[model samples]
Target: MSGPGYRRVAVPVDGGDLAVGVWEPAGETKGTALLVHGVTSSHLAFTHLARRLPGLRLIAPDLRGRGGSHAVRGPAGMEAHARDLVAVLDAFGLESVPVVGHSMGAFVAVVLAHRAPDRVTGLVLIDGGLPLAAPAGLSAEDTVAAILGPTAARLSMRFRDVDAYLDFWHEHPAFAGRWTRELEAYFAYDLVPGDGGLRPATSYATTVDDTIDLTTGDALREALASLDTPTLMLTAPRGLLDEEPGLYEESRLATMLAGLPAVRHQRVEGVNHYTLVMSPEGADAVAPAVAGVLAGERSTA
Candidate 1:
């Protein structure tokens, strides 16, 4: 289940088709869950989660602007992503399933729940979902750069080959000394031929479009503001590059969760935003949390 064993399917969406990966359970299926990846990341980000949750079917999709769906022509935003996700569920005949979204995917999940409430049973938002704001006077491009930093820059970089790309990621602080074969495979899948070399398959233009829409768009704020479904927001102590004070600070998270009683916040130690869903330790922590959501259990911060 750890290898690239998931069945890849192209789910048709508006403007084009979306690439989705489905991992059917080896044993009697306990349940099904839809896993959404981050901005600039593919569905392979859930490789660790697939290994941990082998009993349940895991369906993950490369967002319209990333991975196999990078060529999907359309605006990239919460509403666009939510529409694509609903189509993915429809293709699988899934009436409703618990959703686990990481980083920007979490924000998309919130939008999906808001847009089509009955389609999502519950939500597990890892390291994202709350509305994000950029410094005043920042331009659209700089806003994305300020929030994503290297993650956005890497989209335009070209590598000599897959190994070169692997080397680049190996030096990353969040991935340093923690790289696995699964991670290597995920990085390899991220590249596509470009300009006499290979560049990440994620569309830089779409990334910027989505970032600006999320940072300044009213959809996400309006969605979270009127939230009603049960949600668990997991935070990592370290930031994207293993820096201190991850995405959600306690004071800030508390203030954000004040009016939304359905959203609960919990911090996962010894992990960063990337590792929270890309590492074995992270999968262990998240797998059970998803089960709790499916079972209607109350998760406390």
Candidate 2:
């Protein structure tokens, strides 16, 4: 399907290149937004959001060990991911800009704003940012498995062809009844030929490292503790599997926000964690808050 056009750039980093997808506004740009995707997703995941906000220049990057940057070696984690974001900004000659992240990307955005506050003007976190509750005594690997579920499992699975991969996602709980051509593009971009078949572009090992860091490491805590930038978090009522009481429990989220009064919270209805930014309805629910945040206005849904 036809949509907003974007240009790709390969930003040089320490280990390898970070692939950045840049979308420029049709006319004059209102501002710039750096879009970060979730653990097992890619830069193309922002297609819907980019189309929704045509006035803003959107910059999305395939983080190390994911998407076109799959060859990028790492010790992947929030800190390292944050550093790669800084490199993307530097490559574009941007000193600071509003940062928007979804799911795991939310953790990366917080760490970026925390570590390089001078490089971020504001933050919009969709369906993530706050610490996730992990059961005591769970190892990092186990935590990744539990949190990601089928999404993680797909990383190791091989597909006979592109259509086979599409069929798999067609049945995903999060995308059920909401699939669109935009999503098809995003999914198709995730495939890479390997071992006489196709596999997801994101590295399973990298996802594991990132999951452990966000859930168990101290970087997120430090980032949240020192959060000074204007931050807004939008949560989905459902999760990846379309289950109730998504990623963050309501009462638990309230308690977490009680400490960081500066970060405002808003609930977006009818969308799951994945659709919060990937679906048209989800983008409609989110674009306003994102625009409001960038415009220096507080928005609620």
Top lDDT: which candidate number?
2
Q: What is the lDDT of residue 191 in candidate 1?
A: 91
Give candidate 2 misplaced runs (Cα > 4 Å): 1-3, 297-301
Worst 10 residues of 2 by lDDT: 292-301
Cα-based RMSD of candidate 1 = 2.6
Clashes of each: 0, 0
Total colliding residue pairs, candidate 1: 0
Residue 105, candidate 1: alpha-carbon lDDT: 96
**Which pairs clash in the backbone of model 2?**
none
lDDT of 1 at 49: 80
Candidate topping TM-score: 2
On residues 98-139, what C-alpha lDDT tens digit does candidate 2 reach at each position?
A: 899999999999999999998988889999899987776887
- Model 1 regions lying over 4 Å from their true place: 1-5, 297-301
